[model samples]
Target: MDVAEGPSSSSVVSEQTIEAGHTLLLKMPTGDVRPHKIEKDTTVNLGKFGSFHANHLIGQPYGLTYDIVDKSLKVVPPRPIQEVEDTEATNELINDGEFVQPLTSEEIEELKKQGLPADEIVKRQIEQHANYQLKTEYSKEKYKKRKVAKYSKGFSTVIPALYNVCEYWFNKDATRLRDIRPDALSQILNLASIRPGGRYLCVDDASGIVVTGILQRLAGEGRLITICDIESPPAYPCMVQMNFPKEHTAVISSLNWATADEDYTPIVASSEPPTGKFKSEGQKSRLNKRKVASDMLMRHREELFAGEFDGLVIASQYDPWSILERLYPYLGGSASIVVHSPQVQILSDLHAKLRDLPGYLGPSLTEGFLRRYQVLPGRTHPTMNTSGTGGFILHAIKVYDDPNASSVMAHRQKAKKAKLEAEANANAAPATSSAEPERPVSDETLAETTQPIESSDAAMES
Candidate 1:
């Protein structure tokens, strides 16, 4: 029989271009990123930067900067990041007053109304400034950057990768993601050992940010069984925002917490097909859809109950210990485990509890800290305002502990020693009439006698 093949690398690589209907992250001049869906022949409004036709960006590559002119976008070369040398200027005699610039707010607004470009407006402001000449090179560049951020009509198209998506949400509302920074999310993926073709069990309550990261890492080749509440569907808004391909999303299957019990049984759908035709095509289609959905749910439930998942990851609001206790049995031996929470106390408690568990190993609690910096010649320093804590993570591995392991090992050793002693006695003794009755050992008997004894406890643990 012929086997099926997965999608080619080229098909996945084609996503590098900005295509129609693909979700994109527009990074504005002020270091703000906004998500927008591209459509054919539509206008994308960029607020103060102005608006541009969506069709203009349909086939362009990402990471390219564009300038808005006449309500249209034009490709512009990216500015090179270089170090600025210090000049023989000091701020000792600089004035600290607000009226240092002759140009007023009304004049700037008039310049904008006259359709004058942002660069021209900034140039006029610099020319009108009373103390522009006395500023150092670094200070002058900083001033220009600030003015550009305020009035520049330029934006860059950012691909919706994991890091970019995390950054967008982190900047917009860190609370939504429980303050999971990009670095912290990356660390979680690494700690969990997320990879393609690995099965994982996840319980995410951070708007599916954790789930989304797993799916991206899986790359359309793994099973992700998400545990959720029975009352509602999984709230994975971040996953939806990612706009992943159908193959990537298909690997996700959800199991409710109530039904995850080993003793709990689901309501099985009838195996027999409908006997008669429906009154209308629409009715038949609806019935068929429901049947298909039911079948999928039953299959997913069976898979979950079968157990032996590769790893487990949890970022839920529920008690971490309780969640781990329930799902611990499903993981295979030596499987990686990771749990995340915004509060360090929660993970600290879980870490302590895991130490006492029989089938856990090396449980550790960690918190990630990230800081940004401004690099320039003789002017490099960490940014004044940086992200706080990205929350804490608890990572560990699962192992099997057999109750009868020691006893079984002892019994095997005793049997081997006794056999060795008997062989030594026989060699020491001379051949006698009683030995003459010993028949030649057949190949089957010899094989059985030489075969090593295996412990049932060890087999089950594996």
Candidate 2:
């Protein structure tokens, strides 16, 4: 949390413990003032100022302001969650630009004639082949948004680079995943200690596109793979065979205790709600009309993922916070790499949690891009924007942790003899103390952080 004292208002913030529920902000820096009806799991952007998790600040001592540096917020001034009128209308207006009905009947028939439901088909394509989906999803929404003003421009035009990025996301094709050279993959893979015969599991929402790409890239070195999903793939079975031999591919019907042979190809499926909004509280989580509690999900997860995996990857676009909490434990022994969008808050939060694990790309992973793309820290909500929709990738490797008596003593020796060295010499003081907190100025930095959107308006003009 920080204090931004301006001509009109002054503020302070207090950070509550992790998982403390929503974040609350009091405007006017006064008593119990809240923006009308705070939205749940919602983002409160203070414009040119800051934004924060509306839920996390609940129960905090009153009077707080939060900063949305990058995409995550640091609660400087904190207060309990205030009841606000639901902002559903505003949110829908923002998201839909103009709300359109779900897919129409004729469109649904066309999609079914080709394969499964239109939405499911697009979802699966996104997973199996993101590039294909990116090029195609525009057609899916064309009809629904026909009456809406503007929005006619394709979300992503048929730029060859766009397709290039999508194809590149999948396994083992260096030419496809542009910008990331072979050397980078080798370094990351080497650091991960991945070798032939390593058991790998991936849970990505982008059509298993990235996970499958990893598998193909590491093929023939004796790698074992597994996948967990809540939705079925449309062309997945065939896609797998076409990519890798059927002998290597194994799709498990259950994410529970049901097991596959020790050695198998990568598993695949969607993490969508099979039924209901909220289920029983279980290790796993699902949101729908029917909510299952967290416990049931956990029981299912333990039953399925009790075994060892050399590496784990998360690619779900929704609920990254919940997903990481559920999956991090499984990678307790080995390093778990979380790849997500910058807009995803958990990625940054995860980086913060792994404070001890030195030298992660997490700290500066997107620092360059953020410093380049997302400028102002207040107004940039580009396509990959963070006003509750954009996301970013975060990587953390879980390694063994055992209290070695000697090591603990060795490291703590400095703090143990804890001398109050001097009045003004605290190493714990933040580096930006006297220096003005530098805001990004470069167009590249601004571009990197605004959102991961392809050129639309710029191209249309050209």
Candidate 3:
């Protein structure tokens, strides 16, 4: 992040060591404005205006514009560029590291509200790296002359939590998680059948892991019933209380009955104080058996045996059949939303449970392993094989409201219809004019149409 720059303040087109993404926000003497995205090994073009060596841009000053001179950007000797690092641009920025997300809900909604297709909105966010900020710095300038030149203008705001979701999901390593669009989210939720006003639950045994993205998605939709064990005073990530919309939140405490107001369900737990390590398969099995027993022993765990949610997010060690053993029955066919991650134990548990269920929608959980969702860092590489983009996410929903539920089939039909509608928009497209001229058919077409059928007599003659 060290940026060294111009020999002196008056120097025009002086070089600075510009890190990729660290923009040179500046006003130049000649009034040529540019926000240069630092690139490695590539020379930039300013046209008859001028160009500069990518390395030279590293140490440029903020609020100072570099004028293009005689078709090339001016260069100053190796002036030490002061390294600039914004925590907002580092730890907090979505897609700066593992995975990526660039667009915001408000931004996508604005595009949709403005009549953009979900795909187009997503494409735009990806291509232009657009986010929730409405006014581009270019848009903020008083004069139109500089608006295009000084394109940094936009509706700027703090880095958002959903941006993280986009990062993890897309793993593009962009300065923004560019592809997390409303339409895609709408598809995912609708596909999961997370109805408005219906309760959504997330078991946050993973702490500040991948579940944050899932919870954020649910919270964005509407009513949510978040389930988590209070290993600490407040189990859920503080990001929710701080970032999620308040009216959409509903706090449900399901803890020990010995404690007051224990109206609850034991949605999460660990067998051996949830240690982070298990050296061998035997050790893993022993701990798992104890985990299963503990998870099962939780007071009236069977009360949650039936499926009861529009959606459910469970993270940490997937107990395979063990976790679902207590939860699937409660799904009672109403479980339209379910998501999990690489917690192998949970996948194993769910895989077994689905085998018993009438209609389980999943790839073969019996064989192979979970695929790591890949991600790209917005910045350059620290080294190869290490990615900011890569992880796992498993999703499902139980449609059976009854053990003998024939209605599950009906539910699926409706769900398919809803997905089709959401995905394949049925709105009218621009029409072709009746007066438009048409091209004539070719002679080959006429010959093909004119070819005679062979009767028995014609065959004999031939």
lDDT at residue 461 of model 1 (Cα atoms): 78
Question: Each prediction's Cα RMSD?
Answer: 12.8, 26.8, 25.8
Candidate 1: worst-modelled 10 consecutive residues by lDDT: 428-437
- Superposing every Cα of model 2 onto the true structure, what RMSD results? 26.8
What is candidate 3's lDDT per residue for 399-462, written digit by digit as tens? 5333443343445556776777799876433333222123334568777778775667759788
Q: Is candidate 1 or candidate 2 better by TM-score?
A: 1
In lDDT terms, how accurate is model 1?
Answer: 0.82
Candidate 2 local lDDT, residue 249: 45
**Which candidate ranks first by TM-score, i.e. highest?**
1
1-462 per-residue lDDT for model 2 (tens digits): 345754442221222222233222234221112322345577655442335555644444433344334435455443353333322222221332333334455654465455352336445333443232232233333322332211110111111121222333332332233222323333334444555556555554454444444544454454433344443222322122122433334422124112222233334333444573435655134342122323433443554466556666555545555554555555536455645543435556655655544322233233213212423223244445322212344556565544342233333444543443343455542222211123444577777788666668988677
Give TM per candidate.
Answer: 0.82, 0.33, 0.34
lDDT of 1 by residue, 16-60 (tens): 788888888898998888888899999999988889899899888
Evaluation by lDDT, superior candidate among 1 and 3: 1
The runs of at least 3 residues in candidate 1 whose Cα sits more than 4 Å from the true structure, single-residue gaps closed, are 1-9, 98-100, 230-232, 267-283, 404-462
TM-score of 2: 0.33
Model 1: lDDT of residue 110: 88
